[model samples]
Target: MRRSPWATLAVLAFAQFIVVLDVTIVNVALPDIQTDLHFSAENLQWVISAYTLLFGGFLLLGGRMADLLGSRRVFVIGLALFGAMSLLAGLATSPGMLIGARAVQGLGGALLSPAALSILTVTFPHGRQRNIAMGVWGGLAGLGGTLGVVAGGLLVDSLDWRWVFFVNVPIVAVITVITPVFVRHVAAARAGDRAFDAAGAALGTTGLLAVVYGVVRAEPAGWSSPEVIGFLAAGVILLAAFVRVEARAKAPLVPLGLFRSRALSTSSIALGLNGAAFLSMFFLTSLYLQQVRGDSALAAGVHFLPMGGAAIAAAVLSTPLIQRFGTQRVQLGGAALGVAGLFLLMTADAHGGYATALLPGLLLFGTGIIGVGVPAQISAVVDVQRHEAGAASGVVTAFYQVGGALGLAIVTTLSLSRTNAAVAEGASHQQSLVDGFHRGLLIAAIVAAVNIAVTLASPQLTPDAELIAEAAAVA
Candidate 1:
């Protein structure tokens, strides 16, 4: 069947929007969930971390599944599974049930993200067409992320916090019913020869989970404690084994050779840093609004609208700017904006006013993120073969999520440590929380500076130049 390329882009972009939205939609609902389910303080972060960990952990495997099976089949199955899990999460009567359901939903999202991207990568086939489509795809991912907090705030306020999960129903239903009909399917590449990498999947998934578990738990349990040390050690060891297995496997889940590309390698590195900066800020800002300033969930979400709004504007503008100036400039400029933003955020205090203190930083960070995200995505896929596009896309996405998890863990740990010291000085709870947030934003600034430096080192590639290469290569 002849497929409409515009329809395909719309479908894939919609899928990405939904997947990214789920990441932050729960943040505004966290306090409500905690109270309703009576969750312990220590485990509340798990509401976020669990989804990220499992999603990041199994992402490579999911991408490989798309390669070995069909993208359409995997996409449909993933959407169905995700929708079911979302329903289960909404209906949960206990904390354990909710967390478990979230984890499963993450797994399904893991499967969906790469397949959607791969479909876009192959379907678009690189040029002005692909560039504009991908820019929109990346933009929507950014937009949905911003919108999640805002939507979560509104939803949690108007109805129950559970509606955050329940709202996926109609969106999922539309995607599931329409996707197969509109989106062209890519058949498995190595249908006969590819055997599932059971051992590799087990090792990689468990290894990442162990590392994330250790890091997330480090804040509550002191880093030197036996449990923290043991988990970190085990995580490192298991991850080492996973790499070894991948190197030796007949049908490796992840092809290490993909890293040989400077574009992909540097891009992924920047992606990790960007993820750290983006996710950690969201975590800290959400807390600052609710815990420190005593804002309601809806109000907190509304406060983030400025940041999100700025980010969307910047992202939409980035494609043309990159076309004119170059990818490297856009990225480096974005990172610089982020650094300034974080520096501004460092001035945030318990008594800090949003207009004078937070708004400027949010705007700068939003603009910078748009600059960084779009070019980094371009670099990640630019040099890859069409056949390897699925795996390449997945690896980048995995790093992005892993970076977020690690960034959150690191920032949260630093926040806790600083909070402890402030508390020792007899600071009030809110004041201590604000102090910790200040310290965390300082760390975020450093990461953004590094990104700016690295992005400056990347090569220039304009959209027309890329399209020229696409034409020549096709001929």
Candidate 2:
């Protein structure tokens, strides 16, 4: 059965938007939720991190499941679970209930995200059609993050915080109804014999959760504490074991050999680094605007409009630049822009004017992310076999989510360190917050710069460059 590419794209894109939307939507409402739920300061991040930890941890399994099960079946199942969990999240009466629901929601997201991408992978075969479809996919993913901040602020101000979760139901419902008519079902891969790698899945998920838990807890407890060290050590050993198991498994959750592709390997690193910086940008910036500048959530959302617009523009510009200069050049340039943006952001003071200090940095950051993200994503899955695309896409998404987990942990730790130092030195709360933000921004900037250097050094682009060189040799 034939599927309308348009309808399939819409379904997948919308699904992705919901998945990515959750990442930023909660940020604008964090303060409100805290006040109402009596959330402890340390526990505040878990509201977001819980979702990320589960989503990131299980993404590989989800991708593999899509490969084992049918994509259409997985898509529908994932959508239903996510929608139901979203509703549950909206109705939560306690912090534990909310966090539990969020973890479930992330589980649903883990299922849906890879399925959505797999659908896209199958719907558009290779060449121009696939490229165009991927562009839309990439664009929507970035757009979703920007829109989340805007939508979260609007909903929080106009109605209630619960509306953010409730909003997904209508969108998911619409897609659920339309997808069957528009998309065709594909059979599962090797349906009879292969059992899902339950043991591997357990080890991988537990390992990641422990690592993310330790990272997020760093700010609350000093890094040297036994608890932090224990969690980190256990996570590392478990993950190493998971890797070893994957090497020998008959059907590994993530194919260890996929990393053999230069394109895939470099792309994953680039995306991970891009995510590390990009994910933290909004959290830090929004906090600065609301806490220091005293902007309302709505006002902060509006303030981000330029950044959003710049990002959209940058994504639009990426295709042409990538075609002309190639992925390597474009990515390197984008990373440099990100570094510059972070440097500019660090120049902002508590009293700094928005126009002179803030907007420029926001614009640069937005542009950098768009430029890096799209190309990096394209490179990641470009070389994989058709059957392996789902697994490849899952790996890319996992890198992205884990990057967020790590980025948040680092930023939180730095913020706490700076804040503590300021307090010990007799600075006011507002002043300490400013100091923390400044330090965080600087650290993020340094990270971005290192990513830029790493991207420049990546061995993948060397092949493409060699291809060009060989062509010249023949000429």
Write down the TM-score of every candidate. Answer: 0.89, 0.90
Error of 2 at 200 (Å): 2.7
**lDDT accuracy of residue 230 in candidate 1:** 92
Candidate 1 lDDT over residue span 1-475, tens digit each: 8889889989878987988899999998888898999986556667887788778878878877887898888888888888999999999989899999998899899888878876876888666777677667766887898889989999998999999999997889899999978898798876577778768878877877777778767777877889988988998898899899889888787789998888778888888889888888888888788888888889998888998888888866876787788778888889999999999988888786889988999999988887797777776776678666556667777788878777777777777679888999999888888888899898888888999777866667665556433422221
Off by over 4 Å in 1: 1-12, 120-136, 183-186, 323-325, 384-390, 456-475
Query: Which portions of model 2 show Cα errors greater than 4 Å?
Result: 1-5, 193-195, 382-390, 460-475
Number of the top candidate by lDDT?
A: 1
